[model samples]
Target: MENYHLTHEDGKYKLTKENGERASKVFESNKDEAIKSSKDFIQNQGGGSLKIHKNDGGFQEERTYPRANDPKKSKG
Candidate 1:
């Protein structure tokens, strides 16, 4: 599991994974549909999640996962 942040921009959304990996995708014309699709994509990328925080000039938010519990965390 990992934490990923999704930011909305230009009628699309950008995703950043826990390891700093990033990707972007276009969503449906409907705002709600776009948000749902973004969330689903994040969830499918393992035990991660997404959340909306602010609707500034662009949609901004932070996604967090338990450091000790996330499966993606490095074991040392």
Candidate 2:
């Protein structure tokens, strides 16, 4: 499965593939908008893993799109 990330940088939020230097999308809105857009983008790409980071530079959470695509071994 593909893995993507949503991170805060340069006063903007970005969605990028894992370890990518370039953003696939840039969120000019609030974090809420960034999260929603990232979810849609991942879902449209056939679902995948998304790692979200807090503005404090710490890991926030991880989401698996489509719900059913979540790994069986992980409960959270």
Q: What TM-score does model 2 achieve against the real structure?
A: 0.94
Query: What TM-score quantifies how close candidate 1 is to the native fold?
Result: 0.48
For residue 26, model 1's alpha carbon misses the true position, in angstroms, by 3.6
Instruction: Give Cα-based local distance difference scores for all models.
Output: 0.53, 0.94
Pick by lDDT: which candidate is best? 2
| lDDT for 72 (candidate 1) | 57
- Measured with C-alpha atoms, the lDDT of residue 15 in candidate 1 is 56
For model 1, how does the per-residue alpha-carbon lDDT over 1-74 read when each residue is reduced to its tens digit? 55555555666655555457455455535556756676677655554655453435443553433323444553
By summed lDDT, the worst window of 10 consecutive residues in model 1 runs over 62-71
Regions of candidate 2 where Cα sits further than 4 Å from its true position? none
lDDT (Cα, 0-100) at 38 in candidate 1 = 64
Residue 62 lDDT in model 1? 39
Model 1 ranges off by over 4 Å:
18-21, 57-76
